[model samples]
Target: MPPMVVLSFLDAPVVTGPARGLIHLARALPPEVRLHVAILRGRGAGPVPPLDEMSDGALTVHEIQERGPYDPSILARAVAIAWRTGARVVQSHSYKPHLIAMAVRAARRVPWVGHHHGWTAENDKVKRYHRIDAWSLPRADRVVAVAQSARDIVVHEGVRPDRVVVIPNAVDARDLSTPMTREEARAKLGIPEGEFVAAVVGRLSHEKGQDLALRALAQARAQGAQVTFALAGDGPDRAMLEALSRELDLGLAVRFLGHQKLVGVVYKACDMLVMPSRSEAMPNALLEAMTLGLPVVATRVGGVPEVADDGEMAWIVEPESVESLARAVVDCVARPEERARRVAQARSRAAERHDPARRAERYLDLYSALGVR
Candidate 1:
């Protein structure tokens, strides 16, 4: 029997969450499955490390060079790759990829799977793209949502509830096990010894609520908590969030690390992980934090509560509420024993339920159900 060929499309200029998740899933998939990744590189985009290198040669990556964002030939190019690879199923990871997959299906009668990771309406441009995605998703044979909230959003967008399946995001526990101790990571990152550090590891965007995190940090400080904050990702709201941090007079206590490639070190350097997102769809950072054994304080939005139980695996707080966020941070900092207990439970839960291999099996099952032998 020939191996099942699954060709996936991604429009990643850099290694984003969906890109990383696809790579992890590809690596964990059984030997009977061959996963091929095609990344669309637009003109003037900065150098992105080869996906093959990032995947450590686990995937066959094809870089599709595009003239610009609106390149009409991209669809033909993607269709050619699908035919060449003999792909039984075509999966798409983002809005642009979703469009490409729809076109590919028109050209070839292969099964299409649209993977929805939720939308971040940071700007008008992004909202427009999301609208396009909503229009294209219902055409897919199956729509895989990273969270139940995401599944609901797609169902509301006219996709049949039966066609939408909820598949939570996952992480490989072995991949996150850092050899560096907490003190070593802190020293390497120049965080002073004995200071309580809370790290927020996501893009610095409005949806991520970095501004709210700043206010929460200020309030936590005012309430006598000596916790230092490290914001470890960069995005559109960097300048605004930086200015707000300065305006709040949080001078040296907050460190904007600006997109650490070795994010595991950032995870290891911090005493806890803080996710202050106003919205989320099973954030990869939360799963990574849980797997890495960092105590989490996340907002109760989207699929967050589905990943971590409040007061059991993590401390859940209300979204967009600076007061609630501040109180959770202060209280989390005060209770060391509770942090340890929750971290242990979170790690165990992550290992058991969110394992990458288990997630890969679920995808394989989905593929089999789609008639991909």
Candidate 2:
């Protein structure tokens, strides 16, 4: 039997949600099922995926460094790589990979699985890609939606509901199960011992709503909440977000930590995780925070509500409401006993619902049903 080929098209190998999920999936795959990963347009900064490390010697990686997004040569190379490797099933992430997989499937008659990680479509480029995905997904043999929200979009866009499956992103529950204590984690990160720290981990982008979090933090501090905020990850909106922070007079109140590779330490160090994303699709930050037993205050958007429980695992707030966001953070900060209780319940839920091992088994089952031997 040929190996399963997973295609991820992104600028780099960062610790984003989709990348992390792929890493976990590769780690948990059975030895009999060899895995090959192809990164279209090559790697970027940040920690590379541990595919080779995790899959032992069963994983083969192929990278095609295209000069730009519209590079025509990548398509040919990707198709050749899949056909040469005898890919039984080509699972694709994002629009570019979907097109590549489509071409490969057309040539080889092999099945293609489209993986949806949700979309922003905020700009023209993303909008065009979303349009492409909308058209391409229905043609895929199977579509793996990372959340119910994504699956709904897939079904709404004309794909058969039976052909689309929802497989929520997985977190390594074992890593979070025995992480460092909050105090120890804070000490390691050089955070003050008594500060009420809130972590917002995601690309610093408008859609991610990091600006909203800054505003909320500013409001909470103005009301004498005695809190500090940390913005993790980098993006084009960093300058704008920094400017907003300055405008809000959040000089020392906010710290911009640029894409920390050790994201686990960031989760552990924070007193609570705040995800004020105006849009989301099963945010790995929220899931990881929940799994690490960190109290979360997240906006009720997209797949967040699907993945987190309101008032049980997380404090769900309205999207883009600075007041509501601030109030939730302040409330979470004030209630330690409640936080601990929620953490216990959230940990149990995360282990049951989002464990990497279970996620891998589900993918393997999906593969079997898809005729991958």
Candidate 3:
């Protein structure tokens, strides 16, 4: 028999979070299962690295040149790729790709499996496309949420609970947990040694609360905390964050490193991982950081609670409050022994929960349980 095929569509190049999770799952599957991804666009409108180019072993990636951001043509092209690849299971990652998969499935009568990555539909641009999600979601054969919080939203929004599978995020930690020293990682990136480095990883956006982190950093510095902040990943909020950094006179104290290829290196070089997201599903960066044994300080919103308990892993602060967040950072920095113990616990938990091989087997079960709708 031919291998069961999975067709994936992602919005970005770096392939973090659900994208990275899916790739990890795909790579862990048996040889009889074939996986191919069709992305709308990649890093920097940059070249879409071939499927084989980025694979660790045998996973294949097929890239498509997107016309523009959220371009309709990309969705249309995805359908063509699905047919060309002889895919048995159509898996769509991003929201646009979900719509595209449903469209293709509707025409071809194929099972459209959606992996929900929780794109913000409240945006003005996405609000214009409200009808699209409302229309496609009900028709899906199966939908997987990266976080239970995401599943709750889909279920509350009227999607069938049975149809939505709550598969929380998982990771291939062994690959990410490189045995590189912090000094070497810092040297590779030219960061000064001995400075207290606080790293926040995510696209710099309002929802991500990168700006909120900067505000908290500013607050802590004003209170006589000697620290430098580095932000990884870039997005629509780049100019705004850069301006905010300067406005706060965070010169040289905060640096935007842009999108990184080795997030493991970023995690290792940091003293702690801070996520001040106003809204999120379970962020993969948070999981990765925990797996790498770094203490975390994140807002208590979305699936963050699912990743870290209030006093476990790292500090969890109330959302949208700079004062509370600053206190949380100070608390973590002051209690180094407690923080180190928490990091050890977090790494242990991450190893057990997100074991790539185990999660991939669950995905296989999901596939077997899903039939044509």
TM match of model 3 to true structure: 0.90
Put down candidate 3 lDDT per residue, 266-351, tens digits, no spaces. 87788888889888887887888888777889998888898888787779999999998888888887788999889998988888
Give the alpha carbon lDDT tens digit for every residue of 1-373 in model 1: 7678899999888888888887788888888898899889889987655767766777888888999769999999999999998888999988999999998888879899999998877789999998999899999999999999999999999999999888788886555567899889888888888889999989888899989989999999999999989999998899999999989999989999998888898988988999999889889899999988889999999999988999999999999999999999999999999999999999998988888888898898898888878
Question: What TM-score does structure 2 among the candidates reach?
Answer: 0.91
- State residue 241's C-alpha deviation in candidate 1, in Å: 1.5
lDDT of 2 by residue, 29-87 (tens): 87666667786544343344655664454466676776664787887887788767777
Better of 2 and 3 by lDDT: 2
The local lDDT score (0 to 100) that residue 6 gets in candidate 1 is: 90
- TM-score ranking of the models: 1, 2, 3
Error of 1 at 25 (Å): 1.0
Which is better, 1 or 2, measured by TM-score? 1
The reply for model 1, stretches above 4 Å from the true place, is none
Give the clashing pairs for model 3. Answer: 51-61
